[model samples]
Target: MNARTADAPAANPTSAPAGTLLHELSSSPIAESLRRELLKRWPSTPDRVREISRYALLAPGKTLRPLLLVASADAVGGSYDGVLPAAMAVEYLHVATLIHDDVIDDDELRRGQRSVHAHYGMADAIVTGDFLILTMFTSLAECVERGVPAAAVLEAVRVLAEAGADVCRGQTKEAELTSDPSSPIADYETVISLKTGALFRGVCRAGAILGGAGPDHTEAVTRFAEHLGLAFQMYDDLLPYLWEPGTTGKPNTSDAGNLRPTFPVLLGYESAGRGDRERFTEALSGRIPAAEAYERLRELLESTGALHRARARAETEAALAREQLAGLPSSEGVGLLAAVAELSINRDR
Candidate 1:
């Protein structure tokens, strides 16, 4: 491990009580309500499939995407009942991505437990992910039954479809970049935007649409969520170095183990001088022991100031996200979303 930067600001930003609020938002009445609805609406047959799918879906999580969807609706004066199904739809899609991501990365842990693939084998995990994808659309269809207009449901479907495809594209690009670990920062930005930002924009846009927002407000929240997504991923990349497996709920070295070119890796390589640059290459290419490589890379990331630079960029993106919130109407929902933008940069996990 590297020494903590004495000059760095406290890890948790003062602008938002991110960790506490995440717990509050996840366990709030709305979240519990979603849980009940999920169990109620879940398919009843094929006991094994239902059981396996529930393992991941019902697992404890921040449920950030669902909260974002619900908050966007509330910001526009929309009711929870009308948007409940869309909330489910987004969570379904989110969980599927997590499961598939773990499979691809060969990660064993998720949310502090054995990952779906590690627990159930690859075949079951793959099919369970597909089942969740099908359920995302089925949940969308339920929105119509909940009194959302058919056209609105259709539009939400279209938005989520595009977002899902973009995530695939982003993952593909990320895999390609692993071969060229020193890829420029701009290319990394493109990948995160497609992978993470697209879904954030889609859910917020769909929530705005279903909540009766006009063109301008929809655009504003979409922009807000996109920036928030960018900052979220930046902070996420910092987590492995900043926190441990117990705190992050996943192996800290998973990214390095898989040879994934994460933000910190790229930034450090760019900023390092001759000696540190050569060491960074050794770590990335596995020329050294796993434990040594992990520690050396962390030290290099800190010494080269890559960690500081990444924190600054995350703060900038969070600020940009908050700026877009001004374009939205004032409400408690907007406040929650604004806090979320702060949380994007401030969170520890």
Candidate 2:
């Protein structure tokens, strides 16, 4: 909500279209495939557990991680059959993370509906998330049954396990920052690199390995994922500050409400003039009431050019991600992957 600066580009209609296409691609095949895989390999007997598991698992998530995994396989001329189990496993893993995230954030809504924890109670939600993670490993085991080599499957398992560890570390660091708001910029980067970027890099690497990609192509996809993940998460952090809460399908004030130091807030802090910085810090410390605090943040971001600079950083990451696609062969698969990088910056929600 800055003054319409010449530096700020108009909302891109093309980016929305790319998002739409990506949405369509993420659903249909991935959803149907995952549904079958989960049903086949589901490891629950309690009727209630099954019901809540389906409730959380079948929610309208983007399935972006699975899209990358399956699409990477396609890009290498590998049949979906070889990677279908791994693809389903990645989808389950991502959904598991979302359920746990909502609980950690104490978020009320997800995908425009009541969050699993909100509707089902905390214990049930926790169990549901754990079940999904359990099923993820089961699905990974099925990958070998689907003709994936044992060595490749083992490596993919190692990558995913490491990423899971990284996510936990990231969350721990984020907690530390939330409690003490003076965290450095480098701390934010490290937290994000583990929490968000690790999964992106791991899944893409897992996909490439499953697809039998050469070492060079696998490395290329890894870099592509790293760039895209940082930009995607930063854009997510910017959404509440830039647009309405409903626009992003979550509570807008959650970060400020929790006093979390997001990238934009931290950037705004660095860029603000001395007086504005003091005012912003007081706002963060809750000297200002909630509603007034948002106003102050908006003013600081606008006058100090922090939001614009954050947007520019995200665009740079997207550009770098697109460049990584050059190492892959030309195909519709590669094109959609490239379009995803474009969609990352253009996305409004």
Candidate 3:
């Protein structure tokens, strides 16, 4: 979803149609209650970590992951009250990853504010990230303390840990690919699956497990979230190229400037004519100005229908996510969950 600052100008009226799923979700009592509980549950800590945590955690968060977890629980006829701990713990894990991600990407801002590392320092950012991860465990333990079944909490923890490991593995793979233009498309897809899809699948499964869903139902939700997550990151990869500066809360051409092998980039190279392929590779090599390179690559993508191909693939994944929702019973929560899946691609930033 697009990030908007309090004072940022309204949409350009020229960008792609922005979806209302996030707006609709934010207005729901389910998401509203989750936001209130999150704010209340935030920990008091040393001034530095508290400030950093507050800035990152309480930013204009969509709370999509937490919402998904709670809804998944409700979809299976579980109690939302019982699933709150899982939902909060998932937020802890997600926010911690965001902190670490900005540090790794050397990004200067987040959600329209200075990044933790930029506002604080690398050391403070690292420590604050670790503190948030520790809180994830606290939130998980709270589930059992709150009278959720011990066995269910244990299963959820196992899945969360596995997903966390996959996240790290995916980050490592991405770092390895940063300089190698010849890196196969396999590497990019694997990275997206591990880095993005892993957490999405894990949280859904964790919620289902909390709801006492059987293995079959849990598996269905897990698969559904996997495709949804991949669609999310793929759209995220496209946003830097598609969005105007400030629309996405970061430099629009940073991805191209950094020469990363994003989905569109790979497709553009494969589909372009021979001469355009050479220019496309040159633009991606960072040997020229990022702005010029960004425009050139975008042109190549459009000419070769690479943009259309990539968008179609993302739409397909999103549709697959919707298909998986059929096993879930009809409810307001289910309806919201379906809308979120649609939001994965229809977003403007």
Ranking by TM-score: 1, 3, 2
TM-score of each: 0.91, 0.88, 0.90
Between prediction 1 and prediction 2, which has the larger TM-score?
1
lDDT per model, in order? 0.81, 0.75, 0.78
Clashing pairs in 2: none
- In terms of lDDT, model 3 sits at 0.78
RMSD to truth, every model: 6.7, 6.9, 5.6
- Clash pairs, candidate 1, are none
How would you order the candidates by lDDT, starting with the best? 1, 3, 2
Q: Write the per-residue lDDT of candidate 2 for residues 216-288, one digit (tens) a residue.
A: 8888888989998898888878888777776677888777766777888888887767887787787678666
Candidate 3, 173-235: lDDT as tens digits = 887777444467778889999999899988888988887788787887888899998888888
- 234-315 in candidate 1: lDDT tens per residue? 8899998988898888998887776666787889888777788778777778556666767877898889899999999999
Task: Provide backbone clash counts, one per model.
Answer: 0, 0, 0
Q: Whose TM-score is greatest here?
A: 1
